[model samples]
Target: MKTTRKILLSAGSVLVLLLTFYLVWANTGLGSETKQSLKIDATASYGDSSNKGNVVGIQAFVEPVDYASEANFRRKIRFYMEEAKKKNWLIPNKSIVVFPEYFGTWLVALQEKERIYSTPEIEEGMQTMVLRNAGRFLATFLKCPQDVQDKLKYSVFAMKAEVIARVYQDTFASLAKEYKVTIVGGSVLLPDPVVENGLLKTRGGLLYNTSVVFETDGTINPQLIKKAFPTADELGFICPVKPEAIPVFNTGAGKMGVLICADAWFSEAYQTLKSKSADFVITPSYSNGYGYWQQPWSGYSGSKTPEKAKADVGKISLGEAWVKYAMATRAKEEAGIKKGINVFLQGKLWNLGADGSTIVLSDSAHATPFVGKSALINLWL
Candidate 1:
């Protein structure tokens, strides 16, 4: 009887251990699956702009002499990437797009002059020379063949265009691998280089100021649209906001749109996003100076104190402008909580909610152009 009781106890102990192991294994798998399902995050980073600095154009001019070093640029990119990683906000299997202000026309012109123009022309062309040299350097870094480099010297614009496209492809591909997110918009610039129109011909034929969208699977979508604009004329470099541009916003698995600095200033762009059912609009602008525009108000004569006059003088106020506009545009349209629009100006990140409210997500002002770093934004529903 004693022997039998001991044997029964051992059997029960073995059964308990097996049950525990099964529960542990099942829960582990379940936990991972839950994490995967709950994955929802997005981010937008403004590429290369200045804050409280002198007025500069949006075109991709070579960095000012003060911040022209390659190391500086790399640091800026690295800092932004690190911030993205820390926020637990990096979306995997999604998209990340960079909007570098003034990238389109300048890059194209620089390359064209470098490869095809005469030596004297290059010397005299300030912007073109700077862009050409930068393109050559980037091409070399990417390990383009010497023969390709030689050819690029004459057809710099074409070569640079191809290089820019490839660079974005590779960068997105790398990010996709690391963070598991698909980078959507390729580097945007003025005037799409792939198209030719007579009226819009500014050196490189009729081109629409355009944005190129790149996919993570190594395929570029709407290749023709790279140079196609809904309302742009052939020779006109400007792309007037049109109702058709709105359709590009309807990206099914949560839409993403990149609006250059000027594009965001217009109400139509926001309306376009709404019409197309875009969930978020990433505005990357390079404003050289204060972009405040105000309307004059008529006033009746009234006495004011000297102190009040001093305080009011030289002060420009856009009272409730952003809020009113946002409410009218985004909220009234039933867009996501006013935070759908992510505005990245220079290195500052501002989260604009659907209600026309704003929250500063990151500020890199204290850090010099390249030395200081900022944090990334984590958007929660």
Candidate 2:
């Protein structure tokens, strides 16, 4: 009996030690060993390349992101810029290149374990991220009582807010300086983002989907554009900011007004731009799910669909709704805007299916939409 008890105790001790080791290993930051490379296979272009437009819209159809390291992400993004350089689409100081929405939001997964990248579902990856940083995440989660609907998402953004800002700002700023062109660095979900001394910083508050614009000299614009309309999916986590005035940035390319995706559907958005006398408008947008563009229109995503847009809700497809109601339709008619750039992000992220045709409008008429990966849609201003 004594020998048996000793044997059982030894086994239990060994088991406990094994569990401890496994927990430490699972939480430890194990960098990804997989070398990622972006292939430009489904390359397509719209508009006349010979026209040499001062404004270029990069239909950055990216693949499933691998946030193993910051450098990997930069390497992948650089491919798009390099491709533009080779085609002479980018002209230093004379060109403004716009990217699609949610371009930097994925930075939340930066420097995660290999498992995070290999997970088939994005939720699983985020779970791993939370598990790895449970203590910090829980602290953040408790701090955000105001965001009862999306406290989990709020916690994720809040816990890693600083790092997300750093990677996102630094990446775009460096790229703009390196390419010597004005870059609208898509959008990132940050808590009350503000520009101070030419750097993007976040104050602890409700998260907002914000877009940052970098000048040719790499200085961030003082005015940070926040999304006025949060989509149905975003409503739980994102807060719409009522700006005192929507800004029209004066750039070498032109007076540019940027309206985030869903905001383009509202007449008030265009009116704001019109009041500013914007020369051109760029709508950085994202459409989730596979083949959603072809799906039947579900009407305006956030808030109430303006009475004018209600009739077309069920009758038209989502793609058609964009052309008829979004920047393509509103830029010229309401804003008297000469050109409009509506760019969509393409690329499958786990179960998050991606679909949208990048549309470029000149004189309010949209060109043949480019539907494929790694495409460049340009309109000569």
Candidate 3:
């Protein structure tokens, strides 16, 4: 009887503690404004006759904000871009600045700052944010009527479709032109992403994980490679693109190819990209969770983990697998490319972990990793 009573008391205390924590979190305001800058590498490698000039990987954090719109993103980006400039990373007219996958996805936080930041879980924050913005969302929805399938799709996308679409387009386009530099502008989720006359557009409501490449003038086309394989965690929100092969992008820098995050994992993406005359590959990636870089690879994600892999695949550390499979084995062997560059997103958002450490892959497995709070890796083209 005494033992039963103690158990009951413990359970009750736990419940009270949870309730108190929730109440405090629910009542909190938005986080304060943060000033941030991206860390850049001093120099990558010198460009040879075959490849392009300097490829610079930028490590940055996207701060939670009440207004992460195009203008706002541009401002925040410029804050760090100034550092790159001061450090002479701009590289005159011959440089290209690269960022990581999902770098643009955090714009959703701006929609409901207090609720988004207060909750330590992204999925929960997004759900509540949807509710908090229901009225505004409904008003926005009525403007675009859809078929049954689109309606179902729109339900998933409606919360921040317009905001994401607008911000994704305007932010990078303006930056490429303003800075007069080529930018593999990271990636964003858009419903049915398309390029209409050298500009990106969205149709329907099913979302795709798409990355864009912008010339100094931000001219469209030879850009917009959609993620062919999205990890299991992404299945809830993203659709794989139908294009069998990625478009070979031609910038002043030379011909380039892109593989968004998980797509970079498979050898097929590399083989197909090389056929299009790509000299090197630019893979924009994101891996969440602290120390995931040092943790075991386990298996593929989303098909995702912390979850263990099946017996056949075996276990390895996450960082090791990335260096071996993602870069050395798949990219170098299958594609037969001389160089590959990767930039990873780094930041904290609710439950999301940003753990990709930036790397530069050469013809051999001798890759240089830039692991720091702020890191930069530069290679001469």
Q: Which candidate number maximizes lDDT?
A: 2
Compute the lDDT of residue 130 as modeled in candidate 3. Answer: 59
lDDT of each: 0.35, 0.80, 0.67
Clash pairs for candidate 2: none
If both were scored by TM-score, which would come out higher, candidate 1 or candidate 3? 3
lDDT of 1 by residue, 1-381 (tens): 999999999999999998777555433321011111111123333322222111111111122221222233323344454555564444444435343443332333322332222223334443444344564545533443333323333233333445444443444345445654434332343324442331111232222345554444434445322321221112223333353453353332356545543344344565665666655554333322222323221111121223423443334232123222322233334443232333222321111101111221122111112111122333332
**RMSDs, each prediction?**
24.9, 3.8, 10.0
When 1 and 2 are scored with lDDT, the better candidate is 2
Residues 123-189, candidate 2: write the lDDT tens digits.
9988888987777899888888575488888888778888989988888889999999899988898
| 2 or 3, greater by TM-score | 2
For model 2 the local lDDT of residue 265 reads: 80
Query: What is the C-alpha RMSD, rounded to one decimal, of candidate 2?
Result: 3.8
TM-score winner: 2
Scored against the true structure, residue 349 in model 2 reaches a CA lDDT of 69
Tens digits of per-residue lDDT for model 3, 185-300 = 78877767777876577775567777888778766554578888878777665667643657887766777788887787776687778778777778888887788777656687
**Model 2: lDDT of residue 281:** 89
